[model samples]
Target: MPDAVVSGTVYDGYGREAGGGLVLEGGVLARVLPRGYSGEADVSGAFIVPGLVDVHCHGGGGASFPDDVDPRSIRKAIGAHRASGTTALLASLVSMADPLPAIRALVPFCESGELAGIHMEGPYVSPHKAGAQNPAAIRGADPEELAAWLEEGKGFVKTMTIAPEADHAMEAVRILLAHGAKPSWGHTAASGETAAQALEATSRCAAELGFEGVPQTVTHLFNAMPPIDHREPGPVREFLAAARKGRAIVETIGDGVHLAPALVEDIHEWAGANAAFVTDAMAAAGMPEGRYALGGLDVDVREGAARLAGRETIAGGCSRLSDQLALFARRGALPFGQIVRACVAVPARAASIERAKGVTLDFEPGKRPNFVVFDRGFSPVCVVRE
Candidate 1:
């Protein structure tokens, strides 16, 4: 196929180049051309980067991933986020009554590539730190049950969130490692030392099982985990230190509602390349302010924040990656390249779904042509898909 060109200040997903145009032949990137080049399409001053990857998102539009079993509903959720510039994402399922039924139902979606994979966010998490997760569904880690879920997923399940402080934590980590799944620690009350020990054990198991490129990460750090204290630092401090050393990745709900702007900036400075930005959005993402469902829990979206109905605990985000990026862009605290790296490269790498048409989270020549074009305000003008 002949190349179709889209010109702009091209960001190759890691850094910006002088080239202001990108050529797409079919869905693969064909060329990175300099300024003043002519192409099939042109948006000369727009910002261009690879399609954003969301590793941790519940649902969007009016479709809830955990509640809707119909394929059409699942497709609706997928379509909702895709329209907003997320080319790839995992369908996050929270704790529920017998989560396996829902897991089995969603297997086909992942197998067919409607979703990047299934992110099982619960049933094995800590009851103490269960934020929006249903406490009734929380339980101790069971390697046998974990193996069963993996088997049912048929390689469609990419990641699982486990509370590292739970009983049989090491064994659960080993189970996940053996079955080619990454364990993301969250929803815990573990001390820093305990968190470090659990992650170390997982690393050792990965090595013994010949697994590579699998690193430990925390799920929505500081939300489901204890706060950092000078006298009683918890997973937050440990995860930050590990992130700084490139030993781990930390997922942050960068939307200002979940974290302060200054704290978000601190994560960017502290974690550097290991910082991954996620929406953790629910069914209200593209919808107007109203009531919604997130894994069977009632949620209310008010002025951009989704919270439990009549409760103080946050349900999830109603904003998409574009909204989160705009917050950072508006603050002017970080470089453009850094923000794109957090949204695309880092999260994709952490979730193990980075491989896309001969390139992973990048917009270079020979890579898959999936990206979003934004105007000066960072609003998504258009999403280009192969």
Candidate 2:
């Protein structure tokens, strides 16, 4: 029996959009009805899509996850993203001298379901490509430190970004996989050959642990890494090649600042389902442009772009996933379905939190009612979660 119904242009998890109505019973989708079906709510002309899942996000609503130890401040950030239609997300912590305190502080949220998991974006990255990361806190890969952080997380640590060329990088990958966390490569100065070797080694480790289907990711591809030149291809080429082969997922900040629209389109065309969209947002997201903090670094947000206080390096993103989705929809550079897949499906799969948490990316029967409604302009009208 249907307790409620929402009719509109519905987008399924696999990027298929059509005019239909979703029947809800007991807080789960009971059935998907055809177009023009009478329902409790007739949201005609609105777009209905799965609740967004952001795999990489630092903070929002004036709170910095890497700097805040208070649960109130952390919840504020989570609320900000949730209001913007990101129902699932990973709280990202940047490189700091000691990450254990923050890791312990965030574990409760994970347990309480406020956050899907915690992503440590490293004290084990390259200094040259540190970008907004505090170089002083960056260190060589240490398996012991990684193990301690994972232990404190209590199975809530989802991913960690490490440079492929960092010392003991392979060991760090093994440790992350052993603890049920995925490793993402970024903030590196590794050559193409070194990047390829790292991917091969990571695949071998995952296979040994019976986790071969779970793919490693590349952190915000092309940012915090060397550019691709015809003569010197760098790691970007290797990462994209792996993505094409379905061996890895590449994250792209489609906020129109981290990457150009044309480049975003190109990568989406090349990587398809392997490309995941993320905000990489910070404390300034959903807040007015002003001063903010990411980890230990001071940042200034102006014109919707967050940057280091006095430097040109981009600190983090200010736009939410909804904002990015709107931008892509307006541009029409890629199909609307493709954009949604990158925003919702791919990221959820990358984090491997959908099935584990009973969160489905599609409006399937017996699945939790997690979705968002948007107007013609792509502004979020309402968010629903079971």
Which candidate gets the maximum lDDT versus the true structure?
A: 2
lDDT of 1 by residue, 1-386 (tens): 24566777877666454467777777677877776655657444478777788889888889888988788888888788888888888889998767788788888877766677888897788898999999998988888888988899888677888888888877888888777788899989898999988877877788889887746777888898899888988888888887888777889898889999789889988998898899898998889999999888899999779999999899888878878887898789998889988888888778778773212455567756777888888888878765
- Give the lDDT of residue 297 in candidate 2: 85
lDDT of 2 by residue, 276-375 (tens): 8899999999999889999888999998799999989999899899998999889998999999888888888888887644244767688776778888
TM for every model, in the order presented, reads: 0.94, 0.96
- Over 4 Å off, model 1: 1-3, 16-18, 26-28, 35-40, 43-45, 356-360, 364-367
Clashing pairs in 1: none
Steric clash pairs (candidate 2)? none
